[model samples]
Target: MNVDRRRRRIVVVGGGVAGVEIATSLGRRSKNDQSMPAVILVDRDSAHIWKPMLHTIAAGTRDISQQQTPYLAQARDAGFEYQPGEMCSLNRANRTIGLAPLHAPDGRLLVPAREIAYDTLVISVGSEANDFGTPGVQEYCFKIDSRLQADAFNREVRIRMLQSVAQEQDLSIAIVGGGATGVELAAELMQLTQIAEAYGAPALSSRIRITLIESGPRLLPAFPDDISQATEERLESIGIRVMTNSKVSAATTEGFELDDGPTVTASLKVWAAGVKAPAFLTNLDGLESTRGNQLVVLPSLQTTQDPNIFSLGDCSSLTLSQGERPLPPTAQVAHQQAQHLIRHLPAVISRGKRPPDFNYRDFGSLVSLAEYDAFGSLGKYGLFKGTTIRGRLAQLSHAMLYRSHQARLYGFWRGSLVWMVDRLNMRLRSAIRLD
Candidate 1:
């Protein structure tokens, strides 16, 4: 079988960090080799924004437009076809997937239901907040799962601030969850309050209050104990209340109902807790999956039931033979997996060869607490081991991660231009978004 002689169609569903990298890399690779597969990148949105920055956007400290990459532009620059739609179903027998109809904000139909065929498929649609069937969560809490959601949250904050200033009333916000997303949001929200005051809202800082509620015994439970302790203390110093081991059994119109019968009241509520894949994925074509609905994949990232289908990032679960737990869902994990596929996918598709097992390299995690403080442990691959960094050094390392990501997607000169523009914007514009 001369696999390289055939024209292969590769369709990637999702435009996340992993999906964009794989699609762009594959498209570029195929351009030089006529025998390689043709790539199509399908996503619900026409633009891509790094998920980790959602908290900053929600806090109004970051502008969404400046950070987002338009998908059509990306395709034109990277040599791939861009299809915009939501993936609704998978047909294994026919090797095709169904996309739901696209609609406009005014309830007008834009695109009809369609199906796309693929010789190979990659699923990278990321996870969403897991409410665990908690009552009122869906109805009451604001979430930061998508770019639109983050923007909406910030807009609401601005509206509420205006009303509070007119009425001379204090505004209260309560966030549920102690994980990275929740912690980062709490810090950023405080920073937003400070910036808001600087913009001439004299009493805004003192009139706004933030309370972080965590079900766990400590914040950032994934990090070292000392780091978590330091983070809590820093948050406390900023006038944000930190509540640990305070599980909320239910949410109400007023606020959250604690498990022990106490109630915490707030003007705005946010749920930033656990995460699970989209509900539709659990039943997709009978593929093996974890309880959280993450597709079970082999070490090579191919779905257990279908060799032509693969999954990565937050949507896939792979428990190495030597490990008791699956890899943590993080940007670095997704980026590394995409790199592995870049190296091996061509061999698997073009030469009928096996994909080498992927090995994840962990360099540790960092937490950014707005502009006040940052801390984390950095570790080298082998002999160098671990090094702890705090304050300024940790803050710089955190910023470098996002810059490196931009460099990957935009190339050197373009990425440098973006950095320069961001610096200029910081000096010219107000720190927080007013519009």
Candidate 2:
């Protein structure tokens, strides 16, 4: 297909879930027609993985290999071009972007920084863990914000487990952030110890100490109080200590020192507390941003100052009308925003018009608390006006979120087949604890 013949050129930055979704959808829509716009996906990494699954990888229940999709392969299959490089700056006035130098580990320059022109630029460069300017966090705490960070935490966990086994001592893990990531990681760590013991890792049966620290009064501050209570109870039942109203004043190599001056030492520390837009985004010329440095996007997902530039996922602060608060940085919200853009972009490209306001629909929330089970609220049901499920049902629902995303990218038939295959693979393989 002569995609270049089409006047519209769409450039999507970031290879995470949002970037891939938008690129894939545009490519699929343009497949049999040469008049459709060309799509290019850009990111520093060559592979794409679901950001929501990083916590599971850290806990060692799921191997990172199984969770990642090669960007080259996906681009080829989806009919889009894949470009590997970090974006240095965006120039809305010139309709061009600045690219950073690409280098090899041996210090050889590969691609000299060059500008890429785009009729429409979609900035989906996802957010990173918010340090809140906390002291020692940059040097000490492990964050699961990216695949690299997740891998680092996984390695630390394995090495610590080995050392603990060698010394015949308990393995201690401290997780900061009581949100979904923190709660999920705490549960996954417990499962990892069980899986490790099955694999004959010495002294793995002893008490595994895990502390979940949250600054809020309860876990899952985003969810309803009932759901949060259930999640807290479930964690405590599994012997995972839940500490609410606790703040990490500083992180040391030894462990986290609490605000009240109590030091909690651990073999590993994970920071999942909050998210902030990447620092580079703040410097984008003429773009209005939030306190967290997220690009301030209008209801239509376009930046207020630049209609040609769009952003979604955790990177943009698009507020909802109901609560007058920015939408939570979740996978579902990003997916929904991408779907809206898929429908709206074609018109904007072809007719030289912008779409009307777009609003987000809340699908409730789900939190998977390791193998002891999952708990959260689902929006579809009528019981209590919002049905809350825990245990196996909740687990199935939690798994389905990824499946739902897969279904949207691929069709239902293909997505279902992949899901079944993955389930079977999990059954056959000796579980490798990544956390």
Candidate 3:
């Protein structure tokens, strides 16, 4: 792999929130400076979508077509080059990354493997659900770890719902995990009955059995204990069976088998229990990595083994101080890291300046349970310190996370237009995907 020497090149592997954000920012800046770095964004997928919103797509609460932004269009608008392929290997000494071939839906190879040279590399490959080697999890349980998985889940949901209604039988859905994704997904599935009723199947909600299983003693162990208790109460109140302290030892074609005793029976099973970085990130190309496969990075977000190669998002592990816990894998942390790099990388790349140490501020966490309810905790701050909120106000705040990300990516005016379009679309379109 080789490139023109007139300008430095920044290669961003993985087009997730962090990767895309940094690439777009640096790429746009390059438009003004003749010596500015050329940005090349490589991703496995052809488009981008907020990873947090994947569960919504899985539950048919969102339209994938509208939510996704084509990588080509984003690159054209933000002044970057988009390459389609998944990074297969990183060659640190050679300053290049080998990418896998791109293939069509029909399995024909569209582009052959190649290596891309880079002066600087940013890896934000993100994380995926870890089944912890549980038996049958990979074979039987569905996961909403990517857009394609979410789309497939949505199609399965529509088909299953239709079959259940036609057979006049209950559709049992068991979700393993009490994290935000699993909990929020349970809520969204509840909304399906309402959608069905509106479309013809009255009282369909009663026929859909959803059970949420958690190994921990409580749900949302990361949040304050009160939120966990309240969330369980809320879910139970809405007929969502919450099973705590129940470790799923195995997932079968029928459902989850608990370690201690009973087996939960369900036609559809989803695993959202935990997450770990992609296995390849573990000591990848001689770079250090965590036991969970997250890349070990300096506070400045640079990989410990090589300053030129940086990592962020769920794939990177960093602790602000020794003995302290590494930053949690969340959208907020990824966004802040991307912003920190965006703010300092220009000077760092061009003037040989030392990038400032990355400091992450926890703004708190929010959980929205579809239209039924929402909850949140205001982060460590002033009068609002650890403040808790729920209901409509909380729901609105939860919705703002994606909106703010949209505003950041599309600027204020266009983002506002998107918000308006979403509101209009909600009223004019079916609340659920029938196909």
Any runs in candidate 2 off by more than 4 Å, and if so which? 1-6, 105-110, 380-385, 433-435
Clashing residue pair totals per candidate (backbone < 3 A): 0, 5, 0
Question: For model 3, where is the 10-residue window of minimal lDDT?
Answer: 1-10
Q: Model 3, range 1-435, lDDT digits (tens) per residue? A: 123466789999988889989888887877656578899999998888999899999999899988998888888878888989998899889899998898898999999999998999999999999999999999998999888899998899988888888888889999999999999999999887677778898567878899999999999988889889999999999889999999999999889999997899999999998989989787578999988889999999999999999999999999997437999999999999999999998888889887999988888999989999999999876678789998998899988999998887788999899999999999998887766
What would the per-residue lDDT of candidate 1 be over residues 234-283, giving only the tens digit for each residue? 99999999999998999999999999857999889999999888877887
lDDT of each: 0.89, 0.84, 0.90
Listed in order, each prediction's TM-score against the native is 0.97, 0.94, 0.97
Global lDDT for candidate 3?
0.90
| Pairs that clash in candidate 2 | 58-435, 59-435, 60-433, 60-434, 60-435
Which is better, 2 or 3, measured by lDDT? 3
Which window of ten consecutive residues has the lowest lDDT sum in model 1? 1-10
Candidates in order: C-alpha RMSD to true structure: 2.6, 2.1, 1.7
